[model samples]
Target chain A: MKTKLIITTGAALLFAAGVLANAQRDAIVASLASQAGVSSFNADAGRAMFLGNFTGGKEATPSCTSCHTNNPQAQGRTRVGKVIEPMAVSRNPERFTDPEKVEKWFRRNCTSVLGRECTAEEKGNFLAFMISQ
Target chain B: MKKLTTLVSAAALTVASLPALGASPWMVENNTTKSECSDCHMAYAPGFLPERSWLAIMNNLSDHFGEDASLGDAARQEISNYLVAVAPKELRGVSSIAVPLRITDLRWFRGEHGSRLRNRAENNPNIGTMSNCTGCHRGAERGFFDDD
Candidate 1:
């Protein structure tokens, strides 16, 4: 009976941790939505943005998939052969938890890949897609 | 008298071997420099380049080798200071006026890594670029590059 009780408590704690992580992500997404002047983000649009190709940026990196790969759950490689961690929140729980880091990457990568800063709406959609993954 | 002679010879030999022991490993001691500089590539030892080279690189991080590696002002300043403080005043075979940006362009580096090795690195997917020192020198991050 004691072992069963411990297991149940462990599961509950894990669930609570998951909820807390999601809450943080939700707050960040909410703020992004407010900035974007939208009520919700679209995961399909995010996925399309992740896979779309463009010629605005450097010839080497035309799309997010150029480095991040198509599967968000899989590991990615940088242009210089560095290994990037999986982007999926399920695979890497720490992702999208820090708003500063999230914004930093967006500011740099959007300019690099799309040759411009990503819109607040686009950022929200991308985060929503990654969170869903 | 023989004992004294042997001791004197041993001391002389030790003194002679000091220069032959070579320079100490170029380990990055600063936490901020290590973490910030190593985000994209291996954090190269500052000893490989001159202070001016580091200054040039740090000043133009927005176009760091064709990548937008711009950092926050605080981090940028901290890393730049650390690098300049540790970098060599000058390197051999490089002109005083020249500010070499790539370590691979150094004379010592070219002597160590010839075209054959360069081709191998370029051809191999596992070792995509010659800049990826840790690809062959597994202990590069720890300042040990002798394994290769």
Candidate 2:
């Protein structure tokens, strides 16, 4: 009986943590959507942007694929050869949890690849695609 | 007997006077600096450069190594302060042109590896670049760079 009670409490705590994580992600998504003035996000656009190559940004990193690689689930290497964690939520459960981190990386990487800050719509689409992955 | 004592003292002093082997291990760390710096590459040991180098790098985040790495003033200032505080005392006089804002550019670094490093870092598939300190120095993250 004691063991059963402990298991139930543990399950409840796990569920609570999952809900909190989802809540954080949802809040960021909502803010991005609002900023973009869009009611919905398209995951397909995000995928294209991630894989697309362009000449606008630095020649070293023409697209997200330069560092992140083609597959979101696979580990990638930085220009300096540091290993990057997989972006896919299924492979790495700890991703996209913090809004500040999400915004910060978007600001830095978008500039690296796109040569400018990513639009709110682009940010939302990127998150949507990543979550789907 | 006096000569023997003098010799012993001289030997001890000589050992103490020798230059340190590598950067001092990080005694203090800031979360912002570690996370931000390591996001793109290895969190380089702050003691690997001088205060002037750190200041220059901190000031020019926008064009960091041909990439955009700009940070807000507050975070940038905080990270710069932490790096400056831990910069190597021995390298305090190293000019920026000599080292060129890169730890690997230090004469000590160049002398340590020479031609052997270029082949391994540039050609070896397993170790792609010299900048990946953790590639060979397995204890890079903890500031223990002894194994290489």
Candidate 3:
């Protein structure tokens, strides 16, 4: 009985922690949405960003989902093996505040993923999705 | 007996140089001591690109704009060899699975090329001809385009 109780308690704690983390993510996403002047991240937009093919002529290659999984929870890396964090409202504080690096990565990754420069609206929507996380 | 052994070894060596199709180039690079086509077009998987398209991109690495990415002649040749060996038979964009996708489906990319593509008036521009993806994506490298 004692062992069972212990297991139950542990599971409860883990569940609670998960909820807390999700709440935090929600709050962060809320903040980002306001900044981008959008109310929320559209699931369709995220899907498009994640799954869309590059439309340019430079190369015939992979889509965004090729590395960073369609969702942020599905963390991925570069074809060169660089580690990428989840694109959602990252619990990792480093992601949100690093505007300079954030922009830089968006620029580089957009090219690598899309084989072209992403537009401002696309970037904004992508941010909306990440924030929605 | 020595000749037989040598023949077996040569066969193995030739097979060893082959790049895996339809897999992530990054992870593949980690396992092999050999440099791969992924080292340059770091974003797109081998299967996504037709062999000829890969060759075109690889051949022009030095002129890769956005950042003007450059590759040595040797890397170019080796990558070219790998891609040609693996290029797809069917041209892309013809079927549902065709890559370098059209704008109707890819919302993010559509928005990226939206203005220019829209300006064309008919919304009939071939996604391949617009050059929008290349303006910033910096193809021939192994990753996606970013603003940073």
- Model 3 C-alpha lDDT per residue in residues B52-120, reported as the tens digit of each score: 556566656544533224444565576566556555645534453444322234444455556765466
Docking class of predicted structure 2: medium
Q: Which candidate is the best by lDDT?
A: 1
lDDT of 1 by residue, B63-100 (tens): 67866777899988888877766677888888999999
Select the stronger candidate by lDDT from 1 and 3. Answer: 1
lDDT of 1: 0.86
Worst 10 residues of 1 chain A by lDDT: A54-63
lDDT of 2 by residue, A50-107 (tens): 9999777888899999989999999998888878899987787678889878987898
* DockQ of all predictions against the true structure, Cα-based: 0.48, 0.53, 0.02
> Which candidate number has the best TM-score?
1
lDDT of each: 0.86, 0.81, 0.53
List TM-scores for all candidates, in order: 0.85, 0.83, 0.34
Higher-lDDT candidate among 2 and 3?
2
Give the winner by DockQ: 1 or 3: 1
> How good is the docking of model 3, as DockQ?
0.02
Model 1 misplaced stretches (Cα beyond 4 Å)? A1-13, B1-25
lDDT of 3: 0.53
Worst 10 contiguous positions by lDDT, candidate 2 chain A: A88-97
Residue pairs with backbone overlap in model 2? none
lDDT string for model 1 (A1-133, tens) is 9999999999999999888888888889999999999999999999999989988876677999998999999999887788999999999988887887888789888888888889999999999899889
